[model samples]
Target: MKKTLIIAIVGILTFSCSKKEAEKNTEKTDSTNTVDSINTARTKINDSIKALNSKNRFRDFSGSHQFVYQNDSSPKYSGSINFTKIDGERDNYTLSGNIKSGKNSVTLKGFAQVVSAKHINFTGEITQSIVDNDNGKPYTRKGTKTFMSKDDGKTYRLQDMVNGSGFVDYIDIHF
Candidate 1:
């Protein structure tokens, strides 16, 4: 009877230990799955952000733009501006263009920061050179311009401008 009782107690202890080990393994698997789920969520969110940044409004503004000075109704300096390159992402972009205005023309290289879909701020250097009687003399000008769009970016009204030559009070720009 003593030997039988000792065997029964040993059996119970062994069963209890095996059950505890199984529970521990289950807990470990649950923890690992939770970690993997969090990592997957993070990767998805990061990819979405990257995709949104890649498709910005600047991409739509690429091409040749013809602009007329609204304030000068006499058409003193009507010009066609051609964009050669536009680079960057989101609301910030770097642009290079050639602007021809009557007897004066310049190569404009600039950076634009979008305050909103309807507002933009620009800083650029204008380099000009004389090639013929119609062209202006060689000169360089640095300028900052702020523009606001009243028609949902279809047309921009120049609110203010400051440059090396002087400050232009306000003018309208349409593309």
Candidate 2:
């Protein structure tokens, strides 16, 4: 009877030890799986960010254009505009230029920020100046000629959102 009781106690101890070991192994496996999932998610997020930056790099807005002012059938004035790319979350250009006809000339300064794949907004507010085409009576021209434009890679087709029938004299900036 004593021998039988000892054998039974040994068997129970063995079974209990095996069960505890199995539980420990399962905990280790669960922890490893969680770590692997976190690493995979982090890698995916980094790849997505790199792809976004690469796509934006091609939409660079940096160049120079010699602009000739045309009033009626003749080129009344001449000037140059230079667009310099400013690197940041927003893709844009700082514009600095002028239009000159002999001794008389008008200067321009502003910035244009990309609003779409083919559109940008211009803000000519450096000087806070305005031009009246003819006399000071009609508020014809302001520091900002066009608020928006269509950008087709090479050139910008200026859009005067404030154009009207009475607006006979207009400023056209093609680049």
lDDT of 1 by residue, 20-70 (tens): 999999999999999999999999999898778666655366666754432
lDDT of each: 0.61, 0.58
lDDT of 2 at 4: 96
Deviation (Å) of 150 in candidate 2: 7.4
Best model per TM-score: 1
Off by over 4 Å in 2: 1-58, 126-157, 161-175
The alpha-carbon deviation from the true structure for residue 104 of candidate 2, after best TM-score superposition, in angstroms, is 3.3
Task: State TM-scores per candidate.
Answer: 0.59, 0.49
Cα lDDT over the full model 2: 0.58
lDDT for residue 169 in candidate 1, whole number 0-100: 23
- Among residues 3 or more apart in sequence or in different chains, the pairs in candidate 1 whose N, CA or C atoms overlap within 3 Å are none
The candidate that achieves the highest lDDT relative to the unseen native structure: 1
